[model samples]
Target: MENRNRFPHPLFYLFPLYAIGLYFLVLGVINAYVFLAPISIAALMTMILLPVVRKFENWKINRFLSTFLATCLALSLYLSMFVVISLQANSIYENWDTVSGRVQNTVQKVQESISGISGVSPDKQLEILNIPPSALSSDSTNAVNSQKSEKDSTSKKGETKESTAKQNSGVKAAITNFLDFVGYSLLTFIYIFFFLFYRTKIRLSIVRFFPENQRDKTNKILNGSLSIAKQYLVGRLILIFFLWIIYSVGMAVSGIDSPILISLIAAALSLIPYVGTVIGYVIAMMMAVVSGGETGQYIGVSITYGLAQFVETYILEPFVVGDKVDLNPLVTIIVVVLGGLVWGVVGMVISIPLFGMLKILADQVTVLKPLGYFLGQDDMGSKDDDFLGAIAKKLKRMFK
Candidate 1:
């Protein structure tokens, strides 16, 4: 009888190696699409439009009209969200000076108390705090004396002012850099509109890759991948909305300072995986201290964060996402942390989808099925063994 266990085809090993090489070879070109972001507006529109397109097909509407209506409806919904968030942000900005002063005074008082406990004099505290001597007093006489002393002290002190000004200039420059990034994102969204509008054409082109007999398999894979991408995007949005509601409500009911801002901060941090809540907690507590001028509220904010994370990790994620993502928690965390380290916010946003795509492709490739096993969520028995340990135990038994 023929051996029931068949070795992998000769091409399998070579194909995987070649595929990996090709990935790197075109990584730069691929990164353009992979990192392309729709305007949050255009992205929102795309999500809404996709469903409309499906619904139109169900109703037997003309294909082009269905796509057009979907796109238009999405644009409308996106505009509404834009108006809301923009208005809220602008309202916050209108009272920026008052809010800044309140927060600063609140922090100064906390610093004073902590300095006293640490047995540091106010002068020393100012030095340690690295604030200008001018900030140490409100009285004009003392302020003038401090200024005179600062001038007499050292020319090096004058250098500090120049350094501070340069730092401020650098920040202004960075803002311009960020505007350029937004311009790129807008360009990306324009591309998204065309891709979405003519999605059928893209799929048809991909279909030409495979031989006739294998075309159906290729199409199934294409559809499956698209569905996965859509789910991740929409599901993540759902997760963000739920977090905003729960966090805002908790902060508000607890009488935390700037409950609205706390909620927004939480929503933003929640985008970063594993450690985002910790970062958000620090921010919320700092805001709470300034807003309330109370240590108790600071502690309360921290506790609230701990509770929210507990609920999010144990309750919300499991139930809402339903383990469809199926990433190994360790790998998921490492990927997210690495992404954050590499590219900050943009990296965090793209990491999971990139990871998911890799794992999904691994599952499909015969030679790379082992890689899927390595990255899978299930502990599902592994092939690793310790030969030395086994040999030592066997020798001990023989001696016995």
Candidate 2:
């Protein structure tokens, strides 16, 4: 037999390299945007609103008109809400003295209640808090002198510590915060323009990535991805509305002052994933605890939050959020944590959807298929239920 030369296919071999390189390139681009977070995020938001722009186009509106109208309307709504919340926050701060007093009394009461069964005296228990003596001795100093001394203490010591810490941290925080908000806003706006303008080209480009024979599959996946994104966003917004309703009802039922106002702020922030609502709860409880000297109400609020999350995860997610955007819980956790670490709150909120989109992309590419599988929602789990089930089925068939 004559010796024959056999060589590997170039594109076949290159496909793996292409996938790996493409992913890293994507990651690098994302990192640059993280560094330039605000504008980048703004661009992202604009992309998100591209569908809305298209909606206007269907009405025969000019792109510039639609873009300007949609963007301006969004900005106006946000600013108005921002002003209302800011005013309410300012009012709360103005009456902080009263709020502080009420909180202190409630804490003391809780401490006293806890301390009743303790071996230690209230004075000893005070260090740990939530356990203390029922009695608080009167100060030896006259009321006026005590008030003066307290003012000095609050000014010189209490504020100094917090202010110094914030000052040390504030420079980076302020820059990052400003950039985060403004940058994302601007980026999103720009992205919206480009996305809307090149929407057809983008769709065609995505389809062209596949071989002609598989274009149908690619088209299906692309449409599915976009549909899922829309579903996810709208569902999240719906969940936020539900969260606001739950929080507002709880606060109102508990008879907390400023329930409606605080609820409004909380509801607005609840749109942020995870940390946002927790921050809201802490603020809401603090307000309640301080304003009323009622520790029970604060505890109730915390309970309600826990219950709400439980319902959301088990009930709301399945029914309302839907199973279209399936992603591994582990991946979800990692993405959320890493995004928050790299870009803070905005990163955390969008990480899930972004990762979900990436998963869809990976599914379309063979070399990246392993990554898609890894990021999949299904797993064998620690117990290997699939293995056990297979064994049991085999055993039953054998016996029969």
Q: TM-score, each model?
A: 0.72, 0.67
Q: Which residue window of length 10 is worst by lDDT in model 1?
A: 36-45
Question: Which segments of candidate 1 are over 4 A away from where they belong?
Answer: 1-49, 76-81, 135-182, 380-400
Give the candidate number with the greatest TM-score: 1
Q: Which parts of model 2 have CA positions greater than 4 angstroms off?
A: 1-35, 119-222, 261-284, 293-296, 299-303, 310-316, 379-400
What would the per-residue lDDT of candidate 2 be over residues 55-110, giving only the tens digit for each residue? 99899998878877777766776677777777877887898777666666776677
RMSD of each: 11.2, 9.4
lDDT value, residue 113 of candidate 1: 84
> RMSD in angstroms, candidate 2?
9.4
